[model samples]
Target: MTRVLRLAVSLALLLLAWEGLVLMTGVPHFILPAPHRIAAAFAARFDLLAAHAVITATEILLGLVLGVSAGGLLALTLTASRRVRGWLLPLVIASQAIPVFAIAPLLVLWLGYGLASKVAMAALIIFFPVTVALFEGLRRTDTGWIDLARTMTAGGNAAGWRVMLYLRLPAALPAFGAGLRVAAAVTPIGAVIGEWVGSSGGLGYLMLHANARMQVDLMFAALLVLAVMALALYLAVDRLLNRVLPWAADTTIPATSR
Candidate 1:
């Protein structure tokens, strides 16, 4: 089956199971509304959902752009300069030691309860993976390639920069693509956490209000929307990476009976 068809079938099965369990258990709607109830809530408040979704989407996109750019630059810097790496690498590693949730409040306080805070949160979350992946890729460039480049530029003063630009950068694309996929997957968590901590808009804010009002169905609808958004973003990024980095083909081995 096609991917879309498989996804549809899976969703249908899950909804059926969920509805069946609720019906059999006689659970209260507030506790766990039936799928139909959630659907009703979704349709009823689509306008509200759409408005908040746009804000969240904007934050995620902006964050992704900023994160990828900064991460790529940092990775290049770390690879190119040992002195700088010694100073910056530890700080980068230390930053990840703190939980993102604990940092959300501080980000809100610093950047304020606006788009800035959300964007920063998402970028901060995305930074480490991208930096590490690209740095390792750069560092692990084939020694044979480096030797060839050095021989070619035996008398040139700019040999290092030339090799970095022509050889190392190309080799690192696959690793950077891998890190980008991860960054895209986790992009939503940062924005939503920022919203949950302090925000006037976005799906997280909507869900928070819905829960406070005991609108369980509406809350579920918002959560569903967030899931769909995250899935769509990740798929889009994956497809883009596959197209852009055509040489980085998947090499996963299929399972077979012995």
Candidate 2:
């Protein structure tokens, strides 16, 4: 609750600062609209923005579901074999090295301006962190447990299912949570990037349309919506983690651990 208050205060201050800057700068509304002006834009153009927002939200939700599932399955495979982990790890890392900006256009070209392209872009961004996080957790599985199982003449599958899956994976929740947080943050950016390249709708496309007509207030309003969505996603993920990993529910996370 204290942390929630802190976040609320910080966000309030951020908006205050943003509005103050615009007021002090004496910039034209077309160039840099104040928050009140942005509010007006949101009120006036809400229907349109809401429709686009729904589209983006759908794409983001589908992409996250698909990406996390794929990553988790791949991580399980990586857990089963060092040879596969060694071969695939570099490829995963190398994929991240290529800027999304460079790949987004190709996705647009190949998949065209549709929900598929948007979902693909978001999934591509989300998959790597989850895969890497899970792989790392798998590698760091409890060695003592593995040894004990071996001593008892336990089979590989039984030991893994009994001990590794239940125990080590739970231990790795904090790390996996870190990656999930990253994925949550990146989803909006990835979705927006894809929309910027080709989509007819979404906040990114709306911003483009508004900017072309010198409707800075509308652009600002769209941006605020994007920020809010990202914040909501992060919070939802945090809450889900705490619920699913109840042992971690009472623990205070270190700031740097995120």
Candidate 3:
């Protein structure tokens, strides 16, 4: 409750500042709509905004599921096979070198201006951090635990699998949780960018259309809704991670003590 109050207070202060800036600067409404103008726009176009919000949210959720699954599977594969890791790790690293914005249009072209393209964009954005964090965690699992797993299992390739599944995966859950939090925060970027590149419906599409028409208040409303959605997604992910990996929550230490 206290945290919620603090957040609300901060947001209120920001809106107050924004409105004050507009009033003090005597800016045109088309150039910078005040908070009340945005609120009025939001109230007037609530239904339209709601529909686009649903489409964007669906894209983000689907992309998150696909991205996490692909990332986890690839991390497992890399951990299980050194040869595969040697061949694929460089490719994975190289993929990130190209800007995601550069690929949005290509994705829209290939996947069409549909949900698929937006989901793919979101998945692409989410894939790297998850893969890297989990893979690193798996690789850095304590040798002592592996030795223990080895002693408990029959001596064979099966024993290594056992060690990986039983020891390393559990140890790496915190890292996976961290990756998930990051993915959640950025998932909207991919979907929105894809929509901006080409889309029939979405908050990004609405914003773009509003901007072109000089409906600044409507654009600001869409922007505010998108920001709220992103924040909610991130907070939901954080709460889930806390539930699933409670140990991580209590692991933080004071900086002064350190």
Candidate 4:
């Protein structure tokens, strides 16, 4: 409750400051609409915003699922086979060298400006972080634990698979959780960028049309919605990670100590 109240207060203050700035500057509404104007626009276009927001949210969620699954699978494969890792890791690293914005147009061109393009963009943006985090985690699993497992298993043929399934995967989950949080934070960027490049529906599409029409208030409203959506997704991911990975709790110093 306290946290919620603090957030509300902070937002209210920000809006007030924004409104005051616009009033003082006497800027045209097309350039920078006041907060009240933005609120009015949001209220007037609630249905339109909701429709586009649903599309954006769907793309983000689907992309997250696909990225996480593919990344996890690749990490497992790389961990299980040194030859595959040697061949594939360089390619994965190289892929990130090309900026995502540069690829957005190509994705839209290939995927045809649909949900597929947006989802692919989002998945590609997050894939590297998840793969690297999980791969490192798997690789860095405590050697002592592996030694213990080896001794217990008596070096049988099934020992390797058994150790991996029971020991390595569980130990690596905390790192994966870290990667997932990062992916959640960035997932929206990819979807929005793809939509910006080309899309029939989404908050990014709405923002583009609103800007072209000089509906600055509406554009701000769409931006606000996107910000809220991204924040909510990140918070949800953080909470879920905390709940799922209790053993990996954050080790921040206390405020008093700091």
Candidate 3 Cα errors over 4 Å, as ranges:
154-158, 250-258
171 in model 4: Cα distance from truth in Å?
0.4
In order, the Cα lDDT scores of the candidates are 0.91, 0.83, 0.91, 0.92
Off by over 4 Å in 2: 1-20, 154-162, 249-258
Q: Which sections of candidate 4 miss by over 4 Å?
A: 155-158, 250-258
lDDT of 1 by residue, 120-152 (tens): 999989989999999998998867778878788
Candidate number that wins on lDDT, 3 or 4: 4
Once fitted onto the true fold, the runs of candidate 1 whose alpha carbons sit more than 4 angstroms away are 250-258
Please give the distance, in angstroms, between residue 94's alpha carbon in candidate 1 and its true position after superposition: 1.7
lDDT at position 231, candidate 3: 93
TM-score against native, each model = 0.94, 0.87, 0.93, 0.93
Better of 1 and 4 by TM-score: 1
How far out, in Å, is residue 99 in model 4?
1.5
Candidate 4 residue pairs that clash = none
Residues 124-209 of candidate 4: C-alpha lDDT, one tens digit per residue: 99998999999998998777778878788775665577788899998898889989999999999989998999999999999999
Question: Model 2: how far is 109 from its true place, Å?
Answer: 1.2
State in Å the error of residue 3, model 4.
2.5
